[model samples]
Target: MIEDPQGTILALFAAFCRVGGCFLVLPGFSSARIAMQVRLFLAVAISMAVLPIMWDTIYPKVSGPTSTYIGIIAIETVIGGVIGLITRYYVLGLQFAGTVLTMMIGFTGPPSQDILEDAAENQLTNLISLTGLTVLFMMDFHHVVMRALVDSYTAMPMGGTFSPQGALISLTDALSQTFTIMLSLASPFILYGLLFNVAVGLVNKLAPQLPIYFISLPFLITGGMFLLYFGISSLLEIFANGFVPVFEGR
Candidate 1:
């Protein structure tokens, strides 16, 4: 049944190198909460599934000499990592936006353990990031990533020379687009904080004897909370909608 067991194993490993590399840094899969063993098994399983689909293209590539095989492994890993990074960067951008939103709203509570990771984070930041990620999962974002992984074989064929310049450009463009989207999402809060602070400053000047700083902080927080309550749905909708275009375009 197996004419070339060695070649088949090599081809499967090659597929693993790419798929596992992507999972290494993928957002939800790479979370500290996920055990390494589980990730490894999942990667292996996906690699096995994908290998047959890509058999024609991948089988021929693995029959080369040892040195060539090693090179292909490295190049495939890098390509997968780059693809994973594009998604990671976009999600991290949402986290960064959450941080900005918290600061603007004066939600400077003590940092707590992050819901997804081990690091500490502000409560509001945690909420926004977690909510956005949940929405992404609900929308089946991983399916998109898988589809992209398959399409990548066409875009960056196996055993091709790795292009550092092209990889750098892709990363830079993802960051640029992510920044613009995050900024726009946080703009309303930024403006609210600015105007609220300016008005508070004037009131303090008018009532120099009073502790305006203390008095205004609660109002600032309340206003921000209300604004977030009203806008969060729309904010996440926009965030989820933008993911596909940014990921595909890059």
Candidate 2:
């Protein structure tokens, strides 16, 4: 039989606080589409699996006074939450880029249910977000998340003093880097939109009587769709490459 069952159990629970908090906002895993019960159980499973490895690091801080233990849990939760948010910001950047893409490409369809989230979104944006997330999953992004969480124990140990400034700095850097990468990925479309709109404007100026905008609507959308079809592979490829940079920023 295992000795000190109470200590072991407390350690497991402590580990859960961190892993659960992280996955709570994790991109695909945290989607509203995923049942809360599934998330809870998955978090518990991960905690149990990792607790043995993290026993030395986690068990000591968990054995203090009740108030101290509560504080430790709170601290660990924040650390985990911050780690998750870092990745979440990158995903949000992709969604934001997709939104911009839809507007630029003239795929401004009416709002529809987002397959990935509960919020309303353009269908094209939904398609792009879903595809990007799926590719990330296929690339084993969760493995990266789990590895990062494990390393976080060393970076921000349990019961350690939380630095609000450091957290803000890290969050700010993640956002900056994520959007930079996203803009790079979306640059081709942005340029296309610019050139296409400029041409449309010039044509409208040359023929004031013509309904240039209305005439160009179908062509604009059709051209953007064709560009999307051709460029999607490259767009997602560049995005997948950016995951390394995001983690490096962390």
- Tens-place lDDT per residue, model 2, 40-73, is 9999999998888888999989889999999888
Q: Model 1, which residues run further than 4 Å from truth?
A: none
C-alpha RMSD between model 1 and the true structure: 0.8
Assess every candidate by TM-score: 0.98, 0.97
Q: How do the residues 123-157 of candidate 1 rate in per-residue lDDT, one tens digit apiece? A: 88988888998899999999998888889999899
Model 1 clash pairs?
none
lDDT of 2 at 178: 91
